[model samples]
Target: MDEQVITGTTAAEIAASVRALHERGALRRGDALPPVRELAAQLQVNRNTAVAAYRLLAQAGVVVARGRAGTVIAGVEAVAQEGYAADSVLRDVGTGNPDPGRIPDLSSALARATGRPVLYGEPVIDPALEARALAWVRDDLPDPELRITVTNGAVDAVERLLAQALLRDDAVALEDPCFLASIHTVRHGGYRAVPVPVDAEGMTVDGLRAALDAGVRAIICTPRAQNPTGATLSPARAAALRALLADHPYVLVIEDDHFSMLSQRPYETLIGPGHRRFALVRSVSKFLGPDMCLAIAATDPETADRLAFRLSPGTTWVSHILQRLVLAQLTDGTVLREVADAGRHYASQNAAFAARLTERGLPAEAGDGLNLWVALPVEARIVAERLMRRGWLARTGDEFLLGAHPAPSHHLRLTVHDLTAEEAARLVDDLVEAAGRSAPRS
Candidate 1:
């Protein structure tokens, strides 16, 4: 822009211009704004006016002055609703939750699944349902000898897996910035979480090696659709992890393939052959409707037997009714087909959003799940704070970090799949505006 244009601008105009620069990527989060005096003089606005405008943005979380660092663009969450702040109602872009509409309606399926309850003690885990589950498990597990154990949900399976294999206070290697449920499970189980770093290729083998060397007795990892980061484990990384685990056959390996069927990538099995202690857990929560709350875990017989002690059918079944409903749906082809379609839709939507982000000068990446992971040019926390004022809520990279050292990158984990296309587009624009206001004037 011409210097003469700024020279005649009002404080509000300067602010608007600043936002436009951020939107266009001319300015970005964490960049320092020009000094108030310089900006005021440049815009031909009174110093007081510039100061007032800057203060207003700060209060609204658009920007923050960091001691000697001057003022920076607050992170995008700055646009989040701040308790009825006049007209502030930001969109939710955090927590990669599925769109409610995408969930399969079990009404038609459940109607057909009803029948006389299978007799009590009638084959724990419901043989009929287990049969369907076995197919799903086999579809993901590379080894034929892998045994399956059905449980209430992924969490239920995790609890059982730990109970059978790990004593209290045992060290479990888990991805840093793990799923919230996994974090709580490990802590509540009295096990220490040795944080493993996750990257675009999913869990890092070097980090896993470090955790194992730290004396972790077990490791629970996701080969696909990793939570928070929305990263899938790459083939090479998965192979490396499997090779590393081969050296320590005593360590229990639990791989949570939560997005099993819904995932778009070719499934990669991380558990190597002849590994004595290992389990592959797959959850239908994301694809099968979380309400189903059922998960299938295939483990070695030793772990299955231990889980068997607590996994009784009829009285303690993962609800034969629910199992039957899911089974009937899976077999119906319509439900399974719908699930596959939904996965494709989510992947496409996230990809489109990432494209929009790229247009705004932010290089974003999409994975097989319900969201996009964006690396901001500046601090993610600052960007989130800025977006909060604009009524947008988001997740920062810091929250997902697992290691003792902070994650060095500033990134946003966004779940944008379920939202309408128009809503997503508008959100991208608002995020750009927020980024601009917080974005430092170079």
Candidate 2:
């Protein structure tokens, strides 16, 4: 260890070393650093010098001290980079957000919804929004007889729904590498996440059956554009899921149709007629403006009643003002027009990028959602690491997988919905390079 000497002669040298560590972004808030003794030994510095450096760093507001948590990174998210490229690409291929330009425009009509000042404690449910949102999810949910509830967002709705339905340690089945929010929700609530396998055809019914057999109390399945995968559940596959859930009457099936309005593919009904307990959660966040954090959930009357109770107790309900805003846009002819435009923009961007990939000999294709899933011949982790070097971040299929044995398929979930033509082309080229680099180095 003495052979690897890191001498710090002057105060500037110690300051430079500390600054270098801070610049790397690894040493962030709430993250503990090596003990002064350990670091001094590593850097071959005097213990007093190490203490001085720590003190200097602390004074800079770069980190804070907690008894056990130690020094952590502060003011990180606010720090801006040179171009949006490394940070969020001022042009494209970053932020992983749906194209705001293409979101259903509410500009002309939203003003009318704000006509009246919204009164708190009044029935927060916007009947107009409910009527409109119901139509949006009509194809995938129960008959007109079923009840619907409005929520702040699909995320908020899912959290409330899971809370209402499951107790701690209760088993819930989710697609392997499911949506990040769902995964976090399950963990936050201390619920055991049961993994269900998803292939090109979406979630496998057989895997779901196995999870249920293992005594999962609830199942949350994404029918189409299965988040990172962009694999739509085929009608046949949906039917299989229905039969599996039908056999387990007590298991609550929560189908997340977050991509509803934006997805071009025909919707698949995983919660079949015979399936009694189910909730179809749909959010406008992806297709519509995120500022309008609204979701329309259609479920059986009993489940709706329970969810209402969860949303109730106090006046914690969906805002009528926000709902009215959404309803105004929805009822007007504007949304359908925006939906068409958004769909075209998304399909075109994804298709162009996929075509670029295919040209570079990486087989890729456009899927229904705001993203596309590309499968490489090699492992995705290897490919993703190489991509990280080129300032590209991607959600891997592993994040969505729900199985035990490591059937590692090399796939990347890429969001091209906001990518410009040139950016898309460059991304495809970079991806092909990364894919090549990931090849086994035997």
Candidate 3:
């Protein structure tokens, strides 16, 4: 076999070769590629071409740039959330999806959205939706110069928001156990992910200050319902973070309020009165359903203008139909009631499960989100395997880790909102048994 794994001249050709290598098992995750200069000399191509090739690979999440460590195959690839294994006989509690039964019908809203055809050069954001979104966003954000722009969803909004503000190789502060989409977006855009640990109150003050000191140009935070952990920013924590960020006003701070109206916790923000370069994104997916595919991004006027350039006429404006549909659901009393009910349902179900886990002597914390973050008394992977044997599939916390070669985590993020009372009780028992079985005897 040839030791020369990468072989191509052009950037596209080189990227394709790397992808081929990855697919064939020739390139495993975390395997470092040859240095840019070395690979260029080997391929007889210019150094710039090799650099471009690596850049493309990084952008596709096939590779990652580790600063002084050079590039390596991505430990966590950017793809859709992993769901149940097809043909598996286990009940899947790993999928982070809202209950289909609870998602409100949008037939009436869709019917009303059929009025007009949006043409090129028309306003990218619908006027009525903008007005409503502006009022809604303003009620929460303390910054008065905020502007609203709608995107496909929370992920798209964050991607564009980061792109508008930072360049490739720039450091972006991310929660340690972050949302998968945010993780993927950062990795795919070829940006460095600075781990900011999150406590129960939200992002830790020391973590934020350290990231800032490390020269992070941007910070992506989840104000509420932080995925995987279900942590929300407490008012005191938010105030402290806001105070710290006031000194570094130019660092682009993005707060993804993906849970938004669905969260039981009150909305707290880190963007202070005069803080510049910030974005507050709220997606309709949690309440309206993932298929709704629309999110409102409220950002500073300058960031909004840069985002607008990317969303210009022939570029990537979110569909007007989806925007109108979200607006209709937001304005409709019956739909709003259904959404509110769904939110309560999620909270109640998670709380009940957390209580059961605690009663069983396993500490579990249920925060404001669709999933329950349960700490295991043993390794999460072993407990997950035990659950699989008992016909319950679960998501281990290791999958959400940011740093390289992190210590094994003992938490599992379970989506138990759709489970019945009997089912929930059965799951709790199984989880308790599984944890006990996986625990090493003292």
Candidate 4:
């Protein structure tokens, strides 16, 4: 019998065909795809069309290219609220979220939102909210002339910022083990995600330089409490990155300070003086509550103007009510204290867990943010399986990988800040036992 044939005359049709095949289970994860030239001939289309189709697939995270080794189906974990499992008997330490009990109450804030009715032709942003947001962001921005725009959230701001700056297939430098939402945004937009290796001190200078050399048109980085890994940029590392970015002034640099209010570390930025195009996004989700879904995007004038085109009134402006609510909470003395307390709570809990792991002979350092990135003595996936059996759901580091296929990792990003002292201790004991079981026999 003849082998299964894949065919399409255009890029869209080709992408649709591959997606259909994957959906039908005809193409499994890690399965090899036909070479672009071979597939073009089979489909009777131009080579560029095949290339375009593959590019689309790559951006969608449906497939990955292995250079001369050819393209293959991507084995990506579904992007969702991490560490959540339905109908499970496990304690979940994988959901990257602030404790609900700690989120600032908005009842009074919502009540204060009552005012004169906003109508068409009015400014998109709530004037009062804009004033507060501007003041809040201006404190961190190096550029005095940076303009501010509010969006639904960090993800929304990033999507708009990138959309305004880059064309499809433009390379975007993203930290390896990036945030899930950012990964989804980049893939759905059909951009090449160039991986920038992140270490203890946040984004490495060499990684940034390599990404720039690869012709990446944009970069997205987290200055503190980076997702999954919980890495923060050190002052020295931030200086090095800023120096490198100074030479490539045109590259669109986006800094997502997702943990802005809750971070234990000070904000260290990479956007240098005279850097032409850049944006710094600070979302209030971590403290104000995820449901609040508000972020401030501070960018250079040109990028702000470009972003404004998409956010023009009636198209997709963030709700004025939400803006007022965020502002109210941000400015309220009680809420401010609550946010600060929450930050300290997370830092203490993470440190406690890391110390517990250390006492168990597992060297662990709890990084900033809500999670502890633990290096295991065995394959993380294997240990995760063992954990599942012991009734604990943890996130393996592999789920956050970008670019090429990576070597197997022994890292686990556990959301243990919300865990109680007893609960955390129990989880660490389980993890230690799981690792022991999964370790290779001598």
Candidate 5:
């Protein structure tokens, strides 16, 4: 590709030209581009204009900066996502999904959710939903001066919050063994992910301090029922984090309480009362169902105002119908009871599974979320491979790790809440057999 393939004066124009070249197959993936100064001089534009153009491309994932090696067209990498893989014949114990049998039926809520046509210029959140959401999150959040915003889901809210608060390439603190969607979101946005190590008691104090020292602009945390590991923040841990964050009040803190209604553990927050920027997001997915696609974010007024731009009226606003549906289910007595039962059910089932695994000589713990984080004596990949041979598809813990040299994860996240007794027993036996096969021999 010729250097002249990239041509334009302004930032947008330069970005457009590069995009056009890529579209025409003239600038293929991994192809090096001229240095910023060289490109600026050739195009007769300011060096800053060239820099801005590259920034835009990087943010859009069209190109990536390679330090002294200069910029190159980005090769898209396939990211792993949640839910079951299509057309798989194996019994999928790895899918981090809530039991459909436990999810409250939405048929009755649908009737109540409809009625009242919402026109343009109306409020984005349904009035009833907003009121209920405020009450729902009021006691849990530290800050009293909160404004509510509804987004498609917890992931959408995090993406918007980061976009509003930080620039591309800015550092954001995420749990080391992070959620799949979060890792994908941060990578797709071209942001730097600073890994904050999570333990049995949730995000560690030292890890968080290191992230803050690394100049992270934002921190995404799971207050309870953390994904993969299922580590909930203890009160002591939350207090220690609050103390550490006291000096850096302006750093945006986003607590994703995705398992709010169904969490067996009480909510613990890292956001202190005086914290300048924070958002507490609660999605109804766990108890209500994933297809609902509604999450309520109770955020500081300023953060909420900034988030409004991304969720502009009539453009990206979450549907009022969905909001009403969630609100209807949230307030219904029978539905609330069912959600509570679901929480207890998940806890008991996970505990039972953990006990079975422990009895078989593989130590396992019943974590707060929908899954059990079971540690294996051998490498998780080896055990997973062995399990595959035995007609089971399992998720290895390495898939959730961050950074270039992450510690080898020897664990597997298993969702066994919905499994029948016979299936559960067979799975335990198979897992133990797989681990035994994978263990190193003398």
Candidate 6:
């Protein structure tokens, strides 16, 4: 990577030149570019122009800024994703998915969802769905002036909310050991993620205050059924968070209550009555099935208006048919009962597995949502490797982590609710054996 490879006067022109060079294979991954001052001097451009050019490159994923190490060409890093790996031979406990058998069948509801075809320029939300969705969230959210907007899913809602409220490189607070999609969304959107540590009680107050003091413009919180950790916000914790956030009334708060219907715990909210900007997103994927791909956002009027801008009349609105389908299933008494049964099934299975682990001399607890977050005595990667050898694919805790911690995470997030009795027993035996293998000999 020679300094001569970079050329052009303005920021866009300089960015284009670097892109062209990369396209031609002159600038390879990890190859460092000239320092801002040096590049400005060589190109005879303003220092700000050089900085802007690098910024563009970074935003485009063509380069990464390594602080004082300087800017370098970025590798095509594969982002972590949810669900099972394709063509995996092992029994995959890594998939963070709801048990498919328990998902309420939508075939019966499809007919009820259909009627007169919706046209462009009509209301974006299905009238009935809107009513039901509002009723669904009305009791939980503090804002009486809440408005509902539909999107592709919880991830889409989060992406749009952040896009509407903040600019690129603006800091956003995310829970440490965050959801996979949220992590991907913030990074892909080029926002700086300020990690707030999460514990059994949910996001730590001190951690969030630190993020706020660091000038984070927005906060994305999972009020209940937090992924990976499966930690829910207690009433007291939520109240404390709300009290802390009361002073920062203007900062945008987006609560992702993804496991709304299936969660066994009570819903706790961080949005206080007077908070100016907030959105509570609830996706139907957990109980309705992932392919349903719909979520409702109940938000403040101003945030709703900003979110509506991205969900244009014809092009971006969620399909009316899908919304109707969701409404039909939600309103069905039998389906609701089945959903409740599924919730109990998951809770029981996770509880049974935790008990087995405890009986095996490894203490564990079943938390809310679809997965169990088990703390291991040894390094998670070491245990994971041993599990792999025993024909199990496990999701290690470190994968969900953001920022640096005092020590490496020695935990595993296992989705064992879907496993059979025999399979569950085998997994426990394997896990105990794996942990033993990770121990040092005298």
TM-score computed on alpha carbons, candidate 4: 0.86
Candidate 6 lDDT, tens digit per residue, 1-442? 6788789999999999999999899989899999999999999999999999999988787888878998888775567899998999999998999999999987899889988988879989898899999999999985679999999999999999999998766899999999999999998887888999999999999999999999999999998889989899999999999999999999999999999989899999889998999999999999999999999999999999998899989779999888989999999999999999999988899999999888887789998989999999999999999999999999989889999778878999999998988899889989988887332211
Provide the RMSD of all predictions against the true structure, rounded to 1 decimal: 18.3, 12.2, 4.8, 4.7, 3.2, 2.8
Ranked by lDDT, the better of candidates 2 and 4 is 4
Over 1-442, each residue of candidate 2 has an lDDT whose tens digit, in order, gives 1212323644457656555665775444455566667767877778888777666665555544444655444443321111124444333332346777777667676677785656655555776777776777776674766778888898788888888887655789988767767787776665668888787788897888889888998888888877667778888887777777777876788889887777778888777776667888888787776677998889888889888887762567876667777777767676777877787778777888787677678878877777688889788888877777777776556665544555775888777767666666667767888888332211
lDDT of each: 0.75, 0.72, 0.87, 0.86, 0.90, 0.91
Measured against the true structure, the TM-scores of the candidates, in listed sequence, are 0.76, 0.75, 0.85, 0.86, 0.91, 0.94
lDDT of 5 by residue, 1-442 (tens): 7898787889999999999999899999899999999999999999999999999998777898878889999876667889997899999998999999999998999899887788888888788888898999888874668899999999999999999998777899999899999999988887889999899999999999999999999999998889889999999999999999999999999999999988889889999988999999988888899998889899999999998889988799998888888888988999999999999999999999898888777778898999988898888999999999999999999989896554577899888998999899889888988888332211
Better of 1 and 4 by lDDT: 4
Clash pairs, model 5 backbone: none
- In candidate 6, list every pair of residues with a backbone clash: none
Ranking by lDDT: 6, 5, 3, 4, 1, 2
The order by descending TM-score is 6, 5, 4, 3, 1, 2
Between candidates 1 and 5, name the one with more favorable TM-score: 5
Clash count, candidate 5: 0
Clashing pairs in 3: none
Clashes of each: 31, 14, 0, 0, 0, 0
Q: Which numbered prediction scores highest in lDDT against the true structure?
A: 6
Model 5 ranges with Cα > 4 A deviation: 1-20, 34-56, 67-70, 437-442
Error of 1 at 247 (Å): 1.0
What is the clash count of model 1? 31
Model 1, 220-241: lDDT tens digits are: 8888888877788888988898
